[model samples]
Target: MKEKIKKNKERGIITMEKQRLRKNKGITLIALVITIIVLLILAGVSIAMLTGNNGILSQAQNAKKRTDIASEKEAVSLAYTTAYAKNNGEGKVTYSQMQDALDDNGTNAEASGNIIVYFPDSERYYTVKDGVVEGPFEEKPETELSAVEMFENGQNCDKQDGTCTNETHLHIGDYVNYEEPTSGEPCVIGPSQTGVENYQVYSLENNDLNWRVLGIEEENGEKRLKLVADSPVKRTGVRETEEGETITEGVGPYFDIYGAEGYLYAPDAMDAISQIFKNDDAYEARSMNINDINQALGKTTDEQIKEKNFLTMQGFIQYKESYGPFEGQWTPEDWLKQNRPTSIVSGEVSAYAYLIDNGSLPSELSGIATTVENERLRSMLFDNVEPETGKAYWLASRGVYALSGDSYASFGSGVVTSEDGITVAGVGDYAFNSNGYEFGRSGYAAVRPVVILNSDVLIEKIEDQPDSWQ
Candidate 1:
């Protein structure tokens, strides 16, 4: 019985030991789970602090940017003050002075015109007006301004009344109403005259001239729009006699009057144009040259006649027979060869005739207009105008023409367009007919002014008109 009691005590001791071991294991498992949860929570918080819009790193970067901007602003301010003192306390500083002051501070800056200055360090732009600095903000790219854009933006009209269309598109040949300013210097015509002291001062202010778009052309590395008046503005001879008759007395032999140093783009005409634009330098006014007229007529220079066969013996014979009752003997072939096609517009055939034939003329000059388009172009350029009013309009160009059969040539002569045709005027032509020949037969012409708008000049509005050429 004592041996059984001892065995029971032993069994009880083993059960207690097993229970203690299980409790310790449970405690260890619980501690391990708590430690993992704590680590995960700390990791999430650390991630949140390091990233996103309001993170610690973002705040630090923003603060650094702000500091840099402040430093740049201080530098610009110091430069301005230095420049102001150097200018004897003047309210404004010149562009060079401002640049020099900025350079002295070891700060690099860029300028746009005489206005805005850009700082590269802070990527900020500032305006220096009257020697005062005004900005420390990020710079925005400037929008490119154009004539069509300005018109479509309704800059000149009251949009509330719907007098303007925001989608209006501008094109060549469209009419525009540009009023000459009323307060500028008066335009002086022929300020200095030879043999006589005669000049005219014209005030074109407040005049809304109906100008037609000739097209866009590039002048001096800038694009500009060209416009021509619909009619002659004034009637005057290129070189007028005392009695108001046109003459070419002192013009050098050959056509020297319409060249670079001649009547082409006359200085008097250009000076008058400049005076008209004294209040607004963006607009340039001048007399239309021959090439300008050719462009308006949808023709190009050096293309009016074929270069190879234009003044050939066969072509000359055909031209004379087609357009003349020839009484003068035809010149020798050697003479014809020596004085071949000499000018941009070559051939005995009229420009109108060449256009009608589509620049393809047969040896017999029997080519007919294949389409009515040529006739229309001819009428638009030369015909369909009042004979008296549209008689002679001067084109600032030199012209050369030689008759095949006679000692006839017109050189250094003013090119004029008239109801008769485009011919050399001011300098006379030496021509002989079946009856007789005439020499130095000069005529008078009026001025047709053209206006050129610089690329940067913004137009406020354009009048709506049907395209007549179409």
Candidate 2:
């Protein structure tokens, strides 16, 4: 019986050892399979990234190529336009002509393919090969000649007879105006204000005239006409105070010279003016105020100016003034008044007093008008003023002051102005003062050197929001 028990124990031990070995082998196999699967996934990802057309690397390359092409095309177009202008409305230029001009202007002019130049007026396009001008071919249907047009053989109509044998006369684009009578109207021909300034008149015989037309003129040309039909007169006012002295006071002869129409939002304009003061480097001016504001006229103001915490309008008025019988130009009376108030309570009175005093007031207030006639002042205010006839002005607050709800302390709301002082427009967003505790929310981000008024009240105003008071 002892021998049988010992044999049974030995068998049990051997079986247990075999089972442990089998379990270890199964785990090893499973782990190897998992590792192989992970490796396969990584390989697939790598292949796709390397070969895919829209991969990250390919997209970046394509974007760079597109930008390079656009820049090259612009450079080529500018070169052509400059060459055309230099030649006085005569002589057709081929691509070689343009390429030589560009090279002279320090630009690369190596022709990559067959270079063609199109003239819209003659409807002629000339090709350049081996530095020689070739056939003036008819424009291809698929080719877009936006800046000019080209015609070959003048097949559409007879140039000498001024008549179209085919439907060319009736089918010609809307370039002809039958309403503009040729008699006594003095065929007002030259440059069509916007584009190429070549205009020639052909007497339409038998209802046909082969007039070559070029599209609109180039926008930024040095030799473009600067003729203005009418300009608005800027006026100044002289009011005698109780102390007895002639003082220039009152609003404007606000003119819409550049066809500036619609309501002028005083507060919004003031905010823009403030930004002009803050970014004198961008505007190439010194400060904010009417003068600096004027220098930046015709250009869009900075987007940061709209943050109503920086500027506002004070009042609207009809301004009128005269210098002398010989020198005074008739002035308009409607003016949108503005003020940067230390406090809303006394801001209006202070601004009015400053304007009325005209540099004769106490030292505190006299700083406002010391440099009214300076070149910097005129450049800042008069040069860039874009006032429409029927626009509104707004009142804004500056410095450390608390504003009402939805009203920003720095730049306030815009309001409408009629002939009479009427607040027709609603207050702008964030167009109120901010509380003192919220200085961080109300103050400007940086100190900008700005002209605060027409006088010498130019100073650096702090623009930042603080977390807590000292």
Candidate 3:
């Protein structure tokens, strides 16, 4: 019996040991499964972090690129406007001209930078690198007066025996010298009439005609005359009267008079006057008076025209007292009073201040950076970025006519948070683009900077806000 009891106990101990071993094995299997799952989760997270839209590396690259492009654009714009202002009305400077300037000055493209000026009339943009011109924007059509017309305009002339002849008829007061004469007297031709103040003379040498006045000389209280032609000149009639009277009838009777050689017709001045009146009236219409040209250029004086510049949002506000009225709204008698800087987003305090100071935001600000359809975004950006506080806000909703033409519309509400947890709201889209606005050619485009502010401060502002405001 004693032996049987000991054996039973040993059997119990063995069974217990086996049970313990089985439990350990089960625990090990469970731990292995959990470890596999945890590793899978970690792998998934790693992939998402590297490939997500907001991945750190990608965002950093985009930000860097944006900043670089903005800087480049700003440099280009400053150079162009400065160059234009310096060289206005000197005739359009082709790209090659700019390139030559840069090349002569030894400008460094990578460091000193370059500019490209665009002349729309020439349909070309001149590329200026390191202050040197590179390329013309595009070829332009050559438009010039024809040779015949130019010649007829008195570009051609010839002299024979102290007489000047041109394809176009001659008028009195026209000065002529014989090509053969080394230093002889100049022939002064008298008009058909004394009162004939102006006349058109055709150049027979170059087949051109020009207008001239009669050369009047008073010697001892007696008026003397000179003729473009010397001796008995034969006159041809290009145009005759109805009665077949030669238009040149009373023009001249060439002779050496008062020691001055040439033909003089003091008594027939009235005939010259009559012939001028008989000519077609088209010449009167084709002429451009000085007043017309001045009018076409808008204002002649620099003081009459308004000046503009691209400034930062803060800078615009600082100078708001000087801006003009809103575009298409009203003109100020004192332009300084009426002009004001405005943002796409209404109620942007900074923009209001800027408009009040600068008069107007750049026209390019409306659509140069982005399409005109996104004006609303621009407006929203302005409204959210508050001044002094330096915070930006964004809105959740969209509105109608959010963009006017190519300008962005200001709408919605949101705040931009700073890295240090400070929050200011009501910024606009064009705030950053405005900085870049003046840096490029007239039609050049730029990207706006995304608003950045303190995130912690943003959350706090939202939490502290009333439910109604939200």
* Candidate number achieving the greatest lDDT relative to the actual structure: 1
Deviating ranges (above 4 Å) for candidate 1? 1-56, 59-145, 148-167, 191-201, 205-208, 235-283, 298-301, 304-388, 405-409, 412-416, 420-443, 464-470
User: Which stretches of model 3 miss by more than 4 angstroms?
Assistant: 1-47, 50-53, 100-470
lDDT of 3 by residue, 1-470 (tens): 99998999888888889999998999999899888888888777767766768876677777886675454444444454444455662323333334344344443222111224444323344444334444433543232322122223432344211144443322232322212112222122233311122221221221112222112222343222211111111122232444865354322211111100001121122122112211211011111111221222233442321121112323333212223212332111121133433332322222211121111334644321112122222222232233223222122111111222323222111112222321222222221121112111111111111111110000000011111101
lDDT of 2 by residue, 21-98 (tens): 988998999888887887887777767775679765787788875575455555556666665676553333334447
Q: Pairing residues by index, what is the TM-score of model 3?
A: 0.18
**True-vs-predicted CA distance for residue 388, candidate 1, Å:** 4.9
Task: List clash counts for every candidate, in order.
Answer: 4, 70, 92
Sort by lDDT, top down from the best? 1, 2, 3
Q: Give all TM-scores, in the order shown.
A: 0.46, 0.20, 0.18
Can you give the lDDT of residue 250 in candidate 2? 27
lDDT of 1 by residue, 1-470 (tens): 88888888887787778888988998998888887777777778768987998888998899998797777767767777787798677434534566778898787886443345688756798765555667764764453445533433433444423233454434443456555556764444442211112333344542334565556665554456666655545322235445967553322111111222222224356335434632342446776565565554444534432331233323332322233333332321212344432322223433222222333435354342222233323332344232233434545444333445644332322334333322222222122222222222222334456777645444543654442211
Backbone clash total for model 3 is 92
Give the number of the best model, judged by TM-score: 1
Where is the poorest 10-residue window by lDDT in model 3? 453-462
Candidate 2 runs further than 4 Å off: 1-42, 77-99, 103-152, 155-163, 167-470
